[model samples]
Target: KISNEITQFTFPFDNDVWSIPVHRDNSYYESTYKKSPMSKTDTINTPATFETKDKLFVAIHEAALTDFASMTLLKAKGNQYKSDLVPWRDGVKVYAQTPFNTPWRTIIVGTKPGDLVTSTLMLNLNEPSKIEDTSWIEPSKYIGIWWGMHLETFTWGQGPKHGATTANTKRYIDFAAEHGLDGVLVEGWNVGWDGDWTADGSSFSFTKPYSDFDLDEITSYAKKKNVRLIGHHETAGAAKHYESQLEEAFKLYNSKGVNAVKTGYVNKYLDKKEWHDGQYGVRHYRKVVETAAKYKIMIDNHEPVKGTGLQRTYPNLMTQEGARGQEYNAWSNDGGNTPEYLNTILFTRMLAGPLDYTPGNFGFDYKLPQGAKVQTTLAAQLALYVVLFSPLQMASDLPENYVGKPEFKFIKEVPCIWADTKPLDSKIGGYNTIARKDWNSENWYLGAITNDEARD
Candidate 1:
């Protein structure tokens, strides 16, 4: 049985209405047609949208970073007592018994589109931080050994050009120390990279380092340099296996004084037939976050569940690569990301949470193995540190790229955490200008970006 006329709600709209749909299902696995309200063309039940005398704006929130709920918005036509009329419906179904709460349905009410940019509704909706001891959790700018592997100049698996070897890692640690950076992320340092990780179910051992990479030596060296080592766990989407090894892996990192980790779920777990955004995936990610918190380890997720406002609840959930990040420019066959890409996400995807976009690319004109090139300028790259909100920002290029470069100053100086933010100017898929005040120093930083067009 369906309920009739749950409530008749109306708001004055001048130009268009933007409505964001909330869903708990894994968005990455679901088809666009199923996930989007606009796809429900024939039915009166469209995604949440507002229509005024002018234009109509429909906004859809894609993918669930967390689980089991469904939400929708329906528009009411004229006053006809017909059974066909569908009233606005926004609800959720959870199989779990009592004492559970549904995720917040965020509706930002504002006069203009930019007004939505400035709203604090999402942060306000989330519960206060569950982390009591935050002394260990600090925002940082990091340099990592991961990029060269992506560039294929170095390999994760052994043989030649192995990126995570002890000697190479020390170079990055030295670079971080020289640059006043706080952390160093070393990926592919473990034993299992030699195999087909996706198929080799339980082959990866997180605690054990590869023959060439000495965990003890590197951790001690980083301590001498006053730099923290950010650990990496590439599960290759084998969540169950990763979970089994989680305790031992985190224990290893903690013992080494490595307080942060970057986890990757690059592919789907074949046996489970599950997507990254599905219920099982959601729970798997949550378990990782909660478990990491238990060990005082901060998490930076790559190819992760879409970040809902969970960071507010779990402060250790520092940042995530939930969108098309900077790496696409290096090896993507699609000719890298466009100028408009960042602007598009700033309003849409970024509304959910912080993104580890991995900004700081100085080699703008450099061509990759795939012949893809970064389209943005050096200035625009500098602006990204301010534009994208992530506590764990990265100076992604190799240390050699920053030598004597003026733009590197911005990357070095930008604060990783902000106390206050003001969305100065914004338009969906067009341009964005944001100003954020540093949390510790109270200094202000501003980042502005234009789409494909050149702007003054």
Candidate 2:
């Protein structure tokens, strides 16, 4: 049974004021430390650390628990203290019996934040790769029909200008083949778009295609161009429905020679009950990865659960859009992501796993439908191809937009996977510089970006 006793633990330091990181939803901005109320389900298992000016830091690592685990920072008046942050006092209580092996409570001591960034502690904690035969898994540069839909230039559904029609897809395939890109992503080719899939969740049918899109024709055309067709399954946050269709959907893709799939969970739960990082959502994601691997299909998850070093075990989990991604620039009303955004994520969210940020956008001055603008320069956008590490990278802008642009050459030449990475410089939310050696070729690439000010 779970107990609610106020347990007081003492550390070596005696400072009254302390900084603590409260565990919240992974998508939310959580930087400051405050003594506030929080639910047990919302709490993070990772510990809040204490750092000294001399570059010494101490962090408490909690053991993983199957049941909901929550914590609140408590400051002692003398040698003892009481717990008052109890938002989940009446909520679900987790229970465990004896002989249950709890996760390790590790205390990691590091010289600086960068030391932790370079540490292999998380990787060491995970088991080795389960897939012995990884020859089919190759890093790739891809182009897709996603950006135009986000920009409202075309609709996801059938219309005069549908983005995923057979003709439009062939255009993307031609571009990919000419530019030496490995894959093409065609979204909204299915019959579910006309319904309210985001709210109702029963509107999508994965196996069925729209009347305008001939799957066989597009697949054959893509094959002739020597470009792999990356499958798209936008669940619209309907995990339960997607789960039922996994086997058939994967089989269809496998038969069509489609090797990779980009799965999107863009909305909340259909039942309106659970958060994406909760246990239910976590299990659903794992199920997709495991089932996809059975069909030799790699997965790139969008609006996914936070990466917790699962890629080590499941290699088919290529990359995920777990943070604020490039689509924000196309539709966000807040004037898109700041220059410091990616620099901060380099150490924070990226430390968990590879991210599908979809970096290549040449139109720096292009205004979105929401009146927001991309805040970075053309040079900064080029830098992201090297800075953001994803096995599956996308030349996100349209082919027409890239015409006659010299920077487009870098997108074509930049390697998606790296042999080794060196962080030349990193300051949280300020500036970051990184160098990476290409995995196959001996070429090296460097990417650097500053906050809002120009850096020399």
Candidate 3:
């Protein structure tokens, strides 16, 4: 280890791929599908953490200037793996002035998985809430026009089958209102859905809705039903485009009483220059949270940087999608994620913060055209509402699939925010159960899930 920390360096090469050596740590977990929405290559492009075999995941979290990302990086250093902070990604250099205290290097430990599951080390490390008037930052359950696009039952692009049309959005709003859900999310209402938007989102528009969808009318109607219109801003990979329209977009939503938004960074950033969680990516995400705060908007960011307990500083940053989410069950390599997948991540990636795993899917028996299927049982689907922690949760299935099903009641009744969490029997990849006290009511909810084996 070096005695002096160098604030400036004289590397002759460009800042392409660089990381600062933080201290060294032993223990590496065997992870095949570390990144979520599991595909053949989500890892080569996604940020990863140090997963160890000791039934615990340890990481360094930034206390301030969170725009810098830290990692328990896994590199073949001689015979053992060491720790590092992925400071520079591709083009950006992490050069800061001196007198800067390094982020907190933390090691979260537990005898049983429960100890790791319920530990508040991440939240305890972060500063207190920056949003004083946090009444508007609601913990909600929403129904969205999302699964259809993934399921190939509907289209994100404008067409006869466009999922975000005015009619389709109204249908969801009505469903949410009738079911007592707090919000409705309608994606693909904007102008960027056509022709390779994810490859380069320079043409995406945040403020403008497609001609078939009515943002003002939809927002107004949702208000009448006492439901909020959860907004979406998918940048594909064009950060600058989204930044340019950030204020204009926030202004429109604010005027219409849209208090929450789900952002996407499904990017091919700057000819694949910046990483989604690099220093540049970190700064952009932080700006979104700060800017969203001014307009009293809560955010659920996807393809996001790992949560560093920043929600304490910006309560408006509600939750994040950084794990292999439910979508992997519908389409992934090896004919869908293994049954052990969910339990595995619950101990590892979930240690960071609240995750939007979008758990309540009733279509446990459906198969895609290519023969992939959801690996969870119906009971497990219900159990996820209690296990996964997301302030802005989603009942991630079509309304038709949910109606009249007896088990759907659990999704409706589950609480989004919790006052307390109690872990029960658990193994990292076998089975897990947890009970949580509701943030509002005195009601307590318990959720348990297992691997493919039937639990007695």
Candidate with top TM-score is 3
1 against 2, candidate with superior TM-score: 2
Q: What lDDT does the true structure give each of the candidates?
A: 0.71, 0.72, 0.72
Query: Tens digit of lDDT per residue, candidate 2, span 202-302?
Result: 68889899988999999999999999999999887888888999999999999999999999876744235555554456567888998998999999999
Kindly list the per-residue Cα lDDT of model 1 for residues 31-129, writing each as its tens digit: 112222223322222122333344433333322235542233444443211112211222222234566554554555444445555556666777788
Candidate 1 residues lying further than 4 Å off, grouped into runs, are 1-94, 198-201, 269-271
Measured against the true structure, the TM-scores of the candidates, in listed sequence, are: 0.84, 0.84, 0.86
- Per-residue accuracy of model 3 over 1-456 as CA lDDT, tens digit each: 112222221122221221122221101111233432111211121122233444343332333437454444333323223333444543334545665545555555456667766767777877798888888877999999999988888888988889999888999999999999999998899998998776778888898899999888888899999999999998886777789889989988999999999998775342256655556777888899999999999999887777778898999999998766777666665566566777766766676688898878787667676666777888888888888888889999999999899888888888888999998887656788899999999999998888888888
User: Ten consecutive residues with minimal summed lDDT in candidate 2?
Assistant: 33-42
Candidate 2 Cα deviation (angstroms), residue 116: 3.1
